[model samples]
Target: MEDLDTLVLRTALRWQATGLPVVLVTVARTWGSSPRPPGSLMAINGRGETVGSVSGGCIEDDLIHRIREGGVQAACATDTPAVLRYGISADEAHRFGLPCGGTVELVLEPVSSRSRLDELLQACLQRRSIERRLDLRTGQVELRDGRRDGVPRLDDTHLATCLGPQARLIVIGAGDLSRFLCQMALGLGFEVVVCDPREEHRASWELDGVVVSREMPDDLILRLRPDARTAVVALTHDPKLDDLALIDALQSDAFYVGAIGSRRNSAQRRERLHMHFDLPEAALQALHGPAGLYIGSKTPAEIALSIMAEVVAVKNGIRRPSPTPVVTGKSLHENPGYEVT
Candidate 1:
């Protein structure tokens, strides 16, 4: 089985064939509060690299060092997974610019082989959540089921959830927020789709890999049936689109279901939902609104960034309890008329 980094490296090689340079970096492990979880990957090429990171630049520098000292070919062939440590340690952390030595282990691999990466990428495209096992004893790799973990022979968790090379995001609307949200979501590896029945908005829409549709949002929600890995963001202010999707989202188990609005708006939205939609206080309250953190974002792009950041946190399996307003800030005032008969 091929890992995400190897697949990225292979992609780099494919791009390189068309005259682009690509490098693959993987996070083999992390100490604390690391930017990316283990198995996180970033690919760089001859011109520029993916912006996120493979560890503090030391590991990147090591790869660059290898590139300079050894040829790119030599660097690429160091196929074995390598362990790196960062920390609460003092001097070691400073050297890598890690706050307190937060060690992040990296497994760097050069991409050129189409054989393994092609297979892995294929599985992801098939929407299969695969667990790829790397045999540390030997450099052999194998892909297995996430649930079964077929090859328990590995000493660690080598499973990286594959969104099939494109992370899938469903945004309801084609407005300014949707445009910004789609673009930002795409940058973060999500294959986004914007749904709106309005003809005027869909015509001018433009974003690569985003599907624009006039289908009813609720219908689309049922059809899409977002999986655990998928995220649904309700962008339109209309509860027709937003609430319907929210109902489906609440039931379907998508990782994140958020509405873009303010605190008061969120409250009213919840009240409307609880009254008519049959959604419980628990489910209606599950939504994040004023979505995004209290980032003080006034512009569309900043708002998009905040939303994307929250989505990533959700993707990383961070569990944020529904904001009770009370625990985190103030408990929301209960609504009286909304109670069911």
Candidate 2:
């Protein structure tokens, strides 16, 4: 499944291509508390159809009402883009269902040939990060190199935002745990690939959205050369398969490299990598052994949930503290008196 941002852009482009008057709305700024952050995208068509979201239902309803009432011109006001603000007053905040004192500013651009949304979407499809600079005065856009995870910048005359590759997950195994992990990752809009050289495991691997590969784990890792938006998780519990994949993933730019195992096994795997592979301390430290936030998971599905949660946390720049580690939870479970030092 495509990520939300990509879905919005693709749908908007389709709407425009069909000669529907579409307005692309971007959340350019926010204050106090907001449902979505800056760079959030939404598209509304002349028929009151919408894809994506800027705020909760209230803001989207307002946008739809405006478009349905005054065609596309209501959102943009003219050929140039328009800036609209909501929740500027206490009453307005309540009406808009924004948190108290919350406010959001949006840029509404009427979709047109000059928008160059097709090129922007193409760049994203090709996994190339590009910044889209919107000339608010002229409604023309410029594309340049940018980070996939960049912040949106709004200035007096322009709105600059980055769009890049979808986050991807490489699972180094094919089993029940990997099955659940792949399913969760697909639902979360990640492009998932499952690799396992074991024919018995590969023979049974059939998931709808994930790509299944029979390549050895290390070879798959090397071939993919995971980028910053990518994540790698080893789940086979076999040292030969998991260890090599972990080594390559840790050395790469993958934002998350992890393995699922017991605390003891996790330590053993790390030792094996460090002792035999000569992996640097930093890379070893980067590995998320016993991957996942400790959520008392026992079933395969629950385990996948925990691991995917940690992967998403790390991807979103959230670092859980010491108390949340699987080791901490397992230790406490194993010994009632165990306390984190």
Q: Using lDDT as the measure, which candidate wins?
A: 2
CA lDDT of 310 in candidate 2?
Answer: 90
Candidate 2 positional error at 117, Å: 1.4
The residue-by-residue lDDT of candidate 1 on 1-341, one tens digit each, is 23344456455657667875455555665766565666666766654445346665665665666555655554555544443455546776676676564777665444444225566666666666666555443445566557311222213534233223345788888878678888777666676778888788788887777888889988998998787767888877777778888888877767788887656677788888888887887776567765665454666777777778888887766768334344456423222211111
lDDT per residue for candidate 2 within 12-66, as digits (tens), equals 9998889899889999999999999999999999999999998888999998998
lDDT of each: 0.64, 0.87
Alpha carbon deviation, residue 126, candidate 1 (Å): 2.9
Instruction: Report how far off residue 340 is in candidate 2 (Å).
Output: 23
* TM-score between model 2 and native: 0.95
Give candidate 2's total backbone clashes. Answer: 0
